[model samples]
Target: MNRRKQKKLTNRLVWAAAVGDTCTVRTVLRTGVDPELPEADGTTALYAASVHGAASTVRALLRAGALPNTESRGITDGTPLCGAAAWGHVATVRELLTHGADPNLREDGGAGSTPLFWARNGASGPHPETEAALVAAGATD
Candidate 1:
């Protein structure tokens, strides 16, 4: 495939993963598509997987060289860790942390909030697993 076609395929795969379409994700990966392609908003396949709580997809993307800390998709201030934490995906958060995602990275656009802050504020109550994951990943306050 040419460069343009390859880019298109990559974008489709990223979108599919972001929407939690695991079947499509698997197929796309099997076709040797790049897993780190970022969407127009700067959201990568990893970010999409994290946002949709697709642990398997996230793992596949990570294994395929997707950077856990990549802040593409115009969300330079937000990390995959933050997305997982904010959405209460404990497993995803842990996976991201284990892959070197920084939990204390401040949000983009001067939000001045870390993943832990977003996790706590967005949570309904005390979530021990999420809290523990964030803390273990070095998130503060």
Candidate 2:
């Protein structure tokens, strides 16, 4: 695919993930879109799905080969695990961890925040299950 087509398809995939549309995500991935394609501002489908608490979408994307630790560069730039945990999505966090997501990765924007930091301090309030999942994964190290 040409760069333009690739970018467009990536955008579609990201949007689909953000909206928790599993069918669209699967369709987009079927077209050969790179699961980790970051939008111009750096948002990725996996990050979008995670932040939206779209567990099934996250699972589909991960099974489609999305990197669990992939981070974006744009306004929403963040790791999938961080996004999931920050939003109090225990299932999503657990799924990412099951896929080997590194919970200790600092926010790519250079902040000291890890998934645990976000889980413990999300604006949505603390999510004990998310935080516990991170600890169980050795994130405190």
TM-score (C-alpha, index-matched) for candidate 1: 0.82
- Stretches of candidate 2 off by over 4 Å are 109-111
For every model shown, what is its TM-score relative to the native structure? Answer: 0.82, 0.94
lDDT of 1 by residue, 1-45 (tens): 687877787888878877878778878878776777675567688
Residue 27, candidate 2: Cα error in Å is 0.4
lDDT (tens digit, per residue) of candidate 2 on 63-121: 99999987877698678888888889999999999998987988875575899999999
Instruction: Give residue 134's error in model 2 in angstroms.
Output: 1.2
Compared with the true structure, all predictions reach lDDT values of 0.75, 0.89
Candidate that would win on lDDT: 2
Candidate 2 achieves a global lDDT of 0.89
RMSD of 2: 1.3
